[model samples]
Target: MEKFKNRWEITQNWQLIFPVIGVIALGYSSFKIANAIISKFGIATIVIVSILCFFLLLKFTLFLFKKLENKWILDQKWEMIRVFIVFAITGSSSMFIGRPIIKFVGITKENLNPIVYWFLFIIIGLIFYQILLVFFGWLFGQFQFFWNFEKKMLRRFGLGRFID
Candidate 1:
């Protein structure tokens, strides 16, 4: 209980639950997608692929955590988990928001060429990602850091005029 309390101080107690749920949801989604694409490849292949995907996800999560470590308000190593959680939520939110807009605009792969559809999807998703990164950072108690980061990124993209 004491240990849990210490960790929760770095983030809201309920907030910690999100990362666990996010990781499980991501893993399940990946497994389903992989299964759909590789069902004919045999169970051994599926298992191996699933393992590889899990490791890749883990690596990416850690990489994100490491990259954002300096910007996070919490300095403890364990806080990296929280940072990863926030990043996952932000990224998922970006894609979720972008998909609806794309669908509304009737930009499906069936309508547009596959390459064009994906290109537009990524562009739209990236726009949402930039906006959501700061929003999620605020929600997770790192607003100032992300706001500065966003400003820097916008400047890099030649939108420095927008930032006062």
Candidate 2:
């Protein structure tokens, strides 16, 4: 049988789907940890454990991505570079968000020690990175749609066609 061709075919790869699923799983685990900590230790504990869970979630995500890189399908080196870029963007952005959220939850300058503050920042950074991992994974999995959509938009804007 002959195969058909399309401009966005590369986006159909399963490499993307797996990562998105991983992200969701990590988020759920973090949520569960938060709930447990809150139940047993109160809101303060929730703040602390939420920070720890973020690190654990990011570690889990990185481990999974490492496994994917070892597999033969997607180019591991390229995938890792892209993942790191995404991690950097998301991690920084998350700190901006997480810091405020943490403060809102009562872990403020007055209440939290310097060590605890730094720990929260690190954990929140990881949490943000994991969130991006999942999101980019899904987006990569759906590349075909985005690719074609971009092409269509470009065409509408009088830009020339984009090749995959």
Candidate 3:
């Protein structure tokens, strides 16, 4: 317990919630993936697959954590989990948000060419992703980190003039 907390620089009890949430989220994600991949399997098989996926995901996440630790500046290591959670939420919400906007704009494969419809859908999703990323970052108390990230991304997209 002490080692886990110390590793993440968790000095306060409230900060412990992030790690717990991260585990639950990861477990749910693993189960979802396993179920989607083998819906016809028995319960035992699915559970086994889910458990396997959980470990695989854990290993992959730890690998990413270590790799990104050097690239990202942070006051505490636990904050990285929070940052990842915000990104997950923002990315999922962006697709839902874009779907409604696309329907509202009356853009559908049946009406428009499939390629054009998909192109517009992706464009709208990206726009919402940019907006939601910062919003979720602020909500999760990582505004500065994601705001700077947003700026760097925009610059790469050649939209630096709008921000500067």
Candidate 4:
């Protein structure tokens, strides 16, 4: 318990538990996603491709973290990892929510031109992403940060007038 607390840089005893829970959840989700992809692509091909993709993704995430490190509210590096895990879950949730809506609306590639289908899909996904960003951020105790980010994203999309 002491080692876990020290490794996560959590000063409070209660705070130490959440990061462990977050990591376990993240690992489970990763495993499920990897298994799904591997089943689709076959074990040998997916194993090789997944390894390469994992390293590339790790590198890119680390680079992104380096750039945002100074600006991020969390002082500890491990906290950022927890935040990233939340962000990933939020993104996946958004996609999961968006896909069924898109299908229900008959916006699939079979029903529309491929480009139009994708465009609509992306637009809907972005809307869900904005909403989920705040919800998940609140769950992860970063609501203020994601709320500001959502506002900035809306402003960029020319929806600034709608934001209060």
Candidate 5:
């Protein structure tokens, strides 16, 4: 508990790259699976797999929420967190995809007011960025706590911090 508190105090930012990498890898895997199944079957297969994956992900998400509640300081609602994740991914990806298309279509200050484009883009990007920062910070901190705790425990048992 003391170690967890100390680590949280020392590093409370987007410091851990592993969790985000893992999540992205999982998402890429899901996309590939969905595409392959869709190709083999049809749009129906894609929809079914997507829905199934969503539910499964939701279940895992809730489990993570519960684990965090038990082990960490944050007491965020699982439903709210889940909704935020969904909205962040959807909104960020849409803007990310749309920005290039808009630019490709020669959207300019004369065509569409620069202020309007900048306002929407900046607002959405900031919102998504803040949400991801909070989520990732909490997740990384939580895992870091357990990881350090395990190391300390093993050292206490004279395991020499490594297994042969």
Candidate 6:
């Protein structure tokens, strides 16, 4: 426990939730991917594949952390996990929220051109993602990081005039 806390610079017990949730989310995602890929296999096979995928995903996530550490200004290493969790939640939520919105607006592949429908779906999702990113970041106590990130993204998209 001490080692883990020291590793992530966690001083408060409440701050431990981010790393724990990150691990559970990663494991659940790995298991779901393994099940989706190997649905025909037996339970034993699925477990093995899920374990393998979990390690692979963990390695990939760690690689990303190492790569992003320099680029991201964070108070502690644990905060990165919270930031990632916010991003994950915002992305999935944007698509989930956008689907009902598109349906409400009478924009579906069945009604609109397939290409146009998909384009609109993506655009709407992106818009919601932008809004939710800061919202979730604030909820997760990382508002400054994501707010700055949002401004940088807008700047890259040629919308710096609106940011000030």
Using lDDT, give the best candidate's number. 3
Question: For candidate 3, lDDT tens digit of each residue in 40-153?
Answer: 988889999999999999999999999999999889999999998998899999999999889998998899999999999999999999999999999999999999999999
Q: What local lDDT does model 6 show for residue 19? A: 92
Off by over 4 Å in 3: none
Residue-level error in angstroms, candidate 4, position 27: 4.9
Error of 6 at 118 (Å): 1.3
Better of 3 and 5 by TM-score: 3
| Number of the top TM-score candidate | 3
Candidate 6 overall Cα lDDT vs. reference? 0.95
What's the TM-score of each model vs. the native? 0.64, 0.35, 0.96, 0.73, 0.32, 0.95
Residues 1-164 of candidate 1: C-alpha lDDT, one tens digit per residue: 55754754434556556557757866876687678879999988887787778778778766876786676566554555655666778898999999999999989988889999999999999999998999888887777767987898899989989897
**Residue 111 in model 6: lDDT:** 92
What TM-score does structure 6 among the candidates reach?
0.95
Candidate 6 ranges with C-alpha deviation above 4 Å = none
Task: Give one digit per residue, the lDDT tens place, for model 5 in 1-164.
Answer: 44633433324334233334445644655666677767678777876786677567757855765676555433333223433344345455656765665577676457777898777666555545444444543554443433444455457767744832
Query: By TM-score, highest first, what's the ranking?
Result: 3, 6, 4, 1, 2, 5
lDDT of 4 by residue, 1-164 (tens): 67766765778766666666654664555455677767687777766665665565657766887898888777666677767877888888989999999988877788789999889989899889888899998987878778887898889988999987
- For model 5, the stretches where C-alpha displacement exceeds 4 angstroms are 1-29, 33-39, 73-164
> Which residues of candidate 2, in runs, are more than 4 Å off?
1-73, 76-81, 140-164
Candidate 6: residue 12 lDDT (0-100): 95
Per-candidate clashes, comma-separated: 0, 0, 0, 0, 0, 0
Task: Supply candidate 1's per-residue lDDT for 158.
Answer: 92
Off by over 4 Å in 4: 1-8, 17-60
